[model samples]
Target: MKKVVITGIGTVNSIAKNCEEFVKGLKDMKIGIDKITQFDTTDHKVKIAAEIKDFDPQKYLDKKTAKRYDRFLQLAIAASDEAIKDSGLENDGEWKENAAVIIGSGIGGFKTLYHEFHVMEKKGPKFVSPFLIPMMIADMASGVVSIKHQLKGPNFTTVSACASAVHSIISSVMLIKSGEVDVAITGGSEAVIDPMPIAAFANMTALSQRNDEPQKASRPFDKERDGFVMGEGAGVLVLESEEHAKARGAKIYGYIAGYGMTGDAYHISQTDPEGTGAARAIKNALDMAKIDPSEVDLINCHATSTPVGDKSEVRAIRNVFGKNATNPIMQSTKTLIGHSLGAAGAVELIASILESQNEFAHGMPNLDNPDEEMKDLNIPKETKNQRIDVVLKNSFGFGGHNASLIFVRD
Candidate 1:
């Protein structure tokens, strides 16, 4: 099997527009959650979210093309453009034919779908836009990206709720390792911060109702944590086989050492109380990496600030790491950027890679005071400089999907 290395990374989130800025924000412990402003949330119980402010799609794509694609696809293209350019793969003689794209989204164009449905109900079915279907489907992001870059190799999308991005990235690594593609632009995007979706999630009690203190609402591992704050953004990475990267003189960020995935078979929207499936996924990833749990330096947890979800993840970590379970530095970036849903894994993975590159583990913002129940592990409250060689990222999603990825410094 060919070794797979991450050559480039890009992200557009509530915190930053690119990887450099994103890492800086993470290290600074900046929180991006704010009162919802994208739509009217007058009737919703939750009225806050982590929204990308003042983003101009025209900066990445032409106005004409930008109008046709949904916000999620626009964000994906913007991030992919940065990743491709950073990889130096856009050159005329580069491995264009051997490159592919795999981007995923949990709920693609929910805003578009909601708006179109309203238009059809009020203005009649004939008034609906003809581009509605293409604009709302989850796979269109990859399709548009492939066309934008003229990548003629394998291209598709994955959908697994919050685990969608990690699954897509893992699949990309497999493609390269199997010698089917030399390079792949892999990531995920989400733009579901609209009023209808927010209301729906709120009705289901899945979102935080701390409307007064939006910035401090997403307090992962804290006893006061109520629920996750919905966030909108995209994250993308340029992945290539180690041999191909070396031949092209590309700068490697890190290697995707291992990947593991499992299904809980317990609940559709809730995690198993014992975290049995999640622990298995973590063990599988470490086993594939041929490393012991003690070797993991840092973990970017998928604790979405929900009461049950946070504890479940902690239990899983303890089960896998055993004696060193509480020793590894762990932080939840979701406290700062809220939950990006489908894009959570990709965004968290980007943060983890940057943490390894900078040799710094960021503190969990707004989590300085955790309850005894949530304090079983060492949760750093301040960014600390450390030699981080290996990092693990965990992402569990709706429908019992669990995925883990291990990234090792190059």
Candidate 2:
């Protein structure tokens, strides 16, 4: 089997518009969650979200193209463009036939759907957009990315809720390992911070109600944590076979050492309190990496700040790491950027890679009071500069899906 490696990565999140700013944001322990400004929240309970401020898609795309694509697509394309360029991939159709695009979006074009639905209701069906279907479908993200880059190989989207992006990356790794593609652009994007989804998630008690303290609301692993803060963004990475990357003299960021995916089969929205499936996923990833639990240097947890979810993930980590439970410096990117849903996994993975490259663990600024269960774990409340090489990134989503990936520095 061929080895899969990451040649480039890019992200556009609430904390930063690009990877360079992202590094500074993480280093500064910046807080991006704040009161929602996109829509009036007079009747809404959850009033905060990590929204991209002053987002002008025209900066990354041509005017006509920017006007046609949805916000999710714009974000995906913007991030992917940076990744492709960073990887030194030619867009002149040189590698089109041997390349693939597999981007994931848990809820694609939601903003478009909501707008069009209102258009049809308020005006008329005839007034609705003819571009609604193409923009609203989840698969369009992958399709649009492939079309933009002229990548003609395997093209599809994976929609497993929050695990979507990690699953997409894992699938891309398989394709490259199987020699089905020489290069793959894989990651996820999400832009669903609209009123409807916020209202739905709020009604389900899946969001924080700390309206006054929006910046400090996403208290992952903290005793005062309520729930996750919604975030919007995209994270993209360019992956290639080890041989292919070397043949082209591409700069290798790191190796996708191993990955493990599993289903909880326990609940649709709630993860198992005991974290059985999550533990299995972590163990399997380490096993595939052929490394002992003690070898992991850092962990980017899927800690969404929900009371149950935070404890459950820590339990899973403890179960898998055993005596090394408190060894790795663990942190969650959600603490800084809120939860980006489908894009959470990929964005967090990119943050992890940055942390590893910088040799530091970003702090959890909102963690005022640590959870009792996490007392033994090495959860950094302040940025800690240290050597980091092997990192584990985990993301579990709705539908009982669990995915974990181990990345090693090249």
Across residues 217-276, which tens digit of lDDT does each residue of candidate 1 receive?
A: 999998888999999899999999999999989999989999899999999899998899
Per-model CA lDDT versus the true structure: 0.91, 0.92
Give one clash count per candidate, in the order shown.
0, 0
lDDT (0-100) at residue 158 of candidate 2? 95
**Stretches > 4 Å off in candidate 2:** none
The digit string of per-residue lDDT tens for model 2 on 1-410 reads: 99999999999999999899999999999999999999999999999999999989998889988888899999998889888888898544677886889999999999999999999999999999999998888888889888877889899999999999999999999999999998999999999999999999999999999999999999999999999999999999999999988998899989999999999999889999999999999999999999898999999999999999999999999999999999999999998999999999999999988888888889988878899999778988899998889999999999999999999988
Poorest stretch of ten by lDDT in candidate 2: 89-98
Residue 27 in candidate 2, Cα distance off native in Å: 0.5
Those runs of model 1 whose alpha carbons end farther than 4 Å from true positions after fitting are none
Q: What is the lDDT of residue 394 in candidate 2?
A: 96
lDDT, candidate 2, residue 50?
Answer: 98
